[model samples]
Target: MAKIDIRRPHSLSVADARSIVDRVAERMREKFGTDSQWSGDTLTFQRSGVKGAIAVVPGEVHVTAELGMLLSPLKGTIEDEIGRKLDEHFA
Candidate 1:
């Protein structure tokens, strides 16, 4: 198994930050068949081989995920993709 954890700081308003996350989540849902839900300030997501939460707080977005055995080898690539997305959307 592999774990990914990322934290990015942003200056956008809470609503705006969440909207960005939602947009990202929508794309993930379409491409990966991920199912997600929001609980307070966190968006939780899961698919066959991955599960994670994106927590949007006052000035930070923290993403954490665990990958199953089949997907473990792609951890670095996945982390880079998340970083790129965070940079694209939150930077």
Candidate 2:
């Protein structure tokens, strides 16, 4: 599996961070129609044979996504999309 991870620090409070994470996870679920679960500081989603996790820390957020197929061509697009969303939601 190919893994992609993104991490960044934000100025929002923990509650706000959690909210942002939830919102992002919801968006991903809606768009991809994936099987997902959120518990405490981590949200994980699996769809189209790909699995992803979004973890929120005290002042930082980390996203780890793994592709289960052999489509290496799509990895960059996936990483860019996740990074863009994180920037938009967290900034």
TM-score of each: 0.98, 0.88
Model 2 misplaced regions, further than 4 Å: none
- How accurate locally is residue 77 in candidate 1, as Cα lDDT from 0 to 100? 95
In model 1, residue pairs whose N, Cα or C atoms come closer than 3 Å (at least 3 residues apart or on different chains), thus clashing, are none
Best by lDDT: 1
- Candidate 1 — what's its lDDT? 0.96
Per-residue C-alpha lDDT of model 2 across residues 47-82, encoded as one tens digit per residue: 886888888888898888889776456899888887
Best by TM-score: 1
Give lDDT: candidate 1, residue 3. 97
Query: Looking at model 2, which ten-residue stretch has the lowest summed lDDT?
Result: 65-74
Which digits, one per residue and each the tens of the lDDT, describe model 1 over residues 1-91? 7999999999998899999999999999999999999999899999999999999998999999999999999999999999999998889
